[model samples]
Target: MSKIKITQVRSTIKRSKRQKATITALGLGKINRSKEVTATPQILGMVEKVKHLVRVEEL
Candidate 1:
């Protein structure tokens, strides 16, 4: 299976509550923080939710 590297490229201060929570759920809170997660359906959904606040790379 493939994996994904999710990085917080921007802040979520003024974003929606769900978007902020999504960043935290991905193990990121501040800009430049990153986490490696499995490319599961659940993670994919979360990524989609906050796609604008993060940068993703295949791993």
Candidate 2:
């Protein structure tokens, strides 16, 4: 599978709990932190849920 990079770009303060949890599940909790993961449908769905809070890059 192709790999993609997920980076947290915004703060989670005052955000919904579901958004926060999705960020955590993506292995990010701090601004500028990044995680490289496989481009699986599940991961893509999680990214979609928190797209406003993260930056995704193809790798």
Candidate 3:
């Protein structure tokens, strides 16, 4: 599997509950926080849902 860095780049205030939950699921609850995770389809889907709130980089 490949790894990717997920970094929270924006505030979650005023966003939908689903979006907030997705961010948490990706190990991000605070702006500027980051987590390195495998690039699975499930993770990719979650990232897509909150694309506007995070920054992704290949590792």
Candidate 4:
């Protein structure tokens, strides 16, 4: 399996609760925070949900 690097490039403050939850689920809370997570369906869904707030790259 491949891995992906997901970076929270934007702030989640003032955003909706769902968005904040998604950020937390992705192990990202502050701007510039990043986490290397496996590429799974659940994670992919979360990434798609907050695609605007993050940057993703394959590793």
Candidate 5:
């Protein structure tokens, strides 16, 4: 599977609990932190849920 980079671009303060959890699930909790992950459907769905909180790039 292809890999992608997920970066936390914004703060989670005042955000919904679900969004915060999704960010944590994606291996991120702080601004500018990044994780490289396989482009699985489940991962993509998580990313979609927190799309506004992160930046995704194909790798």
Candidate 6:
């Protein structure tokens, strides 16, 4: 599987509960925090939900 880097670029404060949960599931809850994960459907869906809050790079 291809690897994709997920980085949290913004704060989660005042965001919806679901958004925060998605960030946490991605192992990123802080600014500049990043995780390289496989590009599975579930993971990609989660990323899409928080696309504004994160930056993604293919590896």
**Each model's lDDT:** 0.93, 0.98, 0.97, 0.95, 0.95, 0.97
Tell me how far the alpha carbon of residue 13 in candidate 3 is from the true structure, in angstroms, after superposition.
Answer: 0.1
lDDT for each residue of candidate 3 in 3-59, tens digit (9 for 90 to 100): 999999999999999999999899999999999999999999999999999999999
Candidate 3: minimum summed lDDT over ten consecutive residues — where? Answer: 19-28
Error of 3 at 30 (Å): 0.5
Candidate 1's TM-score: 0.95
Name every residue pair that clashes in candidate 5.
none
What is the clash count of model 1? 0
**RMSD over all Cα atoms, model 5:** 0.5
Candidate RMSDs in order:
0.6, 0.4, 0.4, 0.6, 0.5, 0.4
Q: Which portions of model 2 miss their true places by more than 4 Å?
A: none
> Model 4 reaches what TM-score against the true structure?
0.95
* Pairs of residues clashing in candidate 6: none
Top model by lDDT, which number? 2
What is the alpha-carbon lDDT of model 2 when measured against the actual structure? 0.98
Worst 10 residues of 1 by lDDT: 17-26
Tens digits of per-residue lDDT, candidate 2, 1-59, equal 99999999999999999999999999999999999999999999999999999999999
Work out candidate 1's RMSD over C-alphas. Answer: 0.6
